[model samples]
Target: MNVLNTDVLVIGSGPSGLAAALEAHRNGANTVIVDSFARAGGQYWMQSKYGLERNDRQMQAGANFITNSENLGIKTITDAEVWGILPKYRVFIQQGSRDSIEITARALVICTGAHDFVMPFTGWTLPGVMTAGAGQRYVKMYGKPPGDKIVLAGSGVFLWAVAATIVKAGGKLEAMVESSSNQFRLFSLIGRHPSRWTETRRLLSPVLRSGVQRLNGYRIDYAQGEDRIEAVKLRQVSNSDRDASQELEMETDCLLVSHGFRPITEITALLRCEHQFDTKKGGWYCKTDPETGATSIDNVYAAGEVTGVTGAQSALIEGALAGLGVSEKLGFTRNGIERKRARLMKRQLRTARFADGLAELFELNTNSMPRIDDNTLVCRCEDVIWGDVLKSWDDGAQNLQAVKYWTRLGMGRCQGRICGVAVSRLLANQFDLDPRIFGFNHPRLPLRPVTVNVVHDALARKSL
Candidate 1:
């Protein structure tokens, strides 16, 4: 095992991680970044492997930022997944087909980003059904459309961005179905942030020009397919009615869906940091100081979506603040650090307000839970259906762990990352209780699945 040391270790390479690394390096800390992807940029700024022309604003910005990091001599470990963290800020990583390496750092900055929040429906496990984030990555990073014909259905502005990307990739978009009926709320949000209008137009124009059907106040009732998705059934949704009888069936080879994003907080949770549940902030998120981005634990900080899903703009600012905080803690504060921190703090306030409105505008509709039948699979990894969970409840299972023990709901390769919240919502809607009462699935070591040899090698170095 190769052992390394750094003054600061940043886990993730997205906007927040890059910004944090840049700030820490400039402040005289030997900062290092590690990402699970093949390249440095994360989902928001995923780089194309085909050397595709850089036309989009995000791509160009990501390219420039990555270049700056390299020019500044910031060390980044690509294709490395941090599977475990030990006492004294010792991190263990597993790279592809290589022996695991351990890095001991003085301080740690966690910026692990978020993933799509998807609900289960009939035929959701079909071959052609996937989350919008997956579809975007397929098109943007791999330069391949998910399917020849795609129908995007979900709540939130992210669908529009995916639709634009599909259109750009020359994929035929059948329609875009949004669950939120309150377009006025979205317009009002954009109205306040005038700078967003340009981005709004940029994402929406291509989809509209292609004449894709845009349906608001609609939700996917279920998907229809054999082995793969060939069509989808969508029903009208409204606050007053909850479920309207009117339904629309669309033919498409692919169905991309996402209710919203859920923050990836396994690292923070594993470290025993304080967390608070807020749906608007993307479920359970790490609690951090607004001024410094410091978590409850000493020498550890969290930023970006791990703190909350506030988009890239806020992540960048929060990352900088966390970097500055770490530098100050390590007694390496540079001149004028306070002034820079003040400016970032003010900008974060504005972005946080916008994030609040965005969350409200695209809030998931709990009423739709009733439409999912008993046979629908809630935990895709474990193949646990809603009926199984209900049966567990009837058998005296009151909380998440009891249900898991009875039905094997959250014990899979994903380790409840995908199915924990979905099952919680199912039980809450059925029993009319708070979702938090079920609590969250406790995170265990080796956060992601790794080869047995990798774990053995890591353990051979030191007792974790």
Candidate 2:
């Protein structure tokens, strides 16, 4: 195993990670970035591999940022997955097929980002059903449409982004169903952040020109098909105590669904950093200082979605702040550092207001989860359905851990990343208690899946 050392180590290559590395390197800290993907850019800045000329503003900005990082001589370990972090910031990484490495850093910046949050419904696990993020990556990164006839049913502006990507890829967008009924809230965003008008217009232009049907206050009740998604049943999401609205069936080969995004907090959780649950900020996110992105632990900081899903703009600012925070902690402060921090802090406040508006615009109602069929699989990894969870509840399983022990609801390859949120909601609805009371799944060693050989080699190393 190769041993490496750096003054600052960043665990992601997205907007936050890249910004963090760049700032740290520029501030005279030996910086290194490690990412699980083969390339530096994370999902939001996913680069195209098809070698096709395109005019994507976000992609171009990401390319420029990555180029700047490379030009600054920052080391980035690609196609590497960090499996464990030991005391003193010793990170064990499995790089590629035949390489394993240990990196010890004086300061660590965690920007693992967030993943799609999808609630379970009937036929959700069937073929041609995926999250909106997956569909976007398929079109943006691989340059291939996920399906011919696509129906995006979820909440948030992310759905619109996916719809635009599909349209750009020349895929047929059947419709876009958003559960949020607050269309007026969207206009309020332009008032708060007038600069967003251009981006918002650009994002909505393609979908509007393509004449895709946009259904507000609608949700997917269930998906239907034989071997793949042939149709989806949509129901109007009512806020009042009125009679249920009629279900509408839409024929489509693909169904992309997302309730929202949840922060990837495994690393912070594993390190026992303080966390608080706020659905608007992406549930169970790491608690950090607003000014510096410092976590509860010393010499460790968190930024970007790991702190909360505040989008890319805020992530970039938070990342730079975290970098500066680390540099200051390491006694590597340069001239005008305090002034730069103040400016970033003020900008973060503005972006945070925008993020708050976004959260309100796409707020999810947990009460609706109880309406899902009992046969719907909540934990896709362990094949645990609502019925199974109810049975566990009947058997005296009151908490998430107890349910896991009784029905294996979260002991799967994803380690509860995919199923934890839904199961928590199910239990909260079943027991009529606050979802936070159940807490999240406890993180264990080997944060991500690792081969036995890699673990063996890591254990054999003296650094362990």
- The per-prediction tally of clashing pairs is 0, 0
Q: For each candidate, C-alpha RMSD in Å?
A: 1.4, 1.5
Residues 1-464 of candidate 1: C-alpha lDDT, one tens digit per residue: 77899999999999999998889898999999999999998877888886643667777788899999999999999999998998779999998767687999999999999988888888888899999999988887778788877899989889988898888777788888898887667888889998778888988888889898889878898898877899899888855665665788899899999888888988999999898999898888999998887999999988899998988889989999998888788988789998999899989988999889998888886754326888999888898998998998998988999989999898998899989988887778778888878777788988988889888987786547
lDDT of 2 by residue, 1-464 (tens): 88999999999999999998888887899999999998888878888886422577778889889999999899999999988998789999999865788999998999999998888888898899999999988887778788888899888999988888788777788899888888667987787799889889989999999998889888788888999889998888866641377568899999998888999999988888899998899888999998888999998899999999989999999999999888788878789988999999999998899999999888888523314678888888788888888988898988888888998987998998878888887677656788898898778878888888788888787655
Against the correct fold, how does model 2 do in TM-score? 0.97
Q: Local distance difference test, per candidate?
A: 0.87, 0.86
**Cα deviation of 394 in candidate 2 (Å)?**
1.5
Runs of candidate 2 exceeding 4 Å displacement:
240-243, 367-371
Q: Model 1, which residues run further than 4 Å from truth?
A: 240-244, 368-370
Residue clash pairs of candidate 1: none
Q: lDDT score of model 2?
A: 0.86
Among the numbered candidates, top lDDT falls to 1
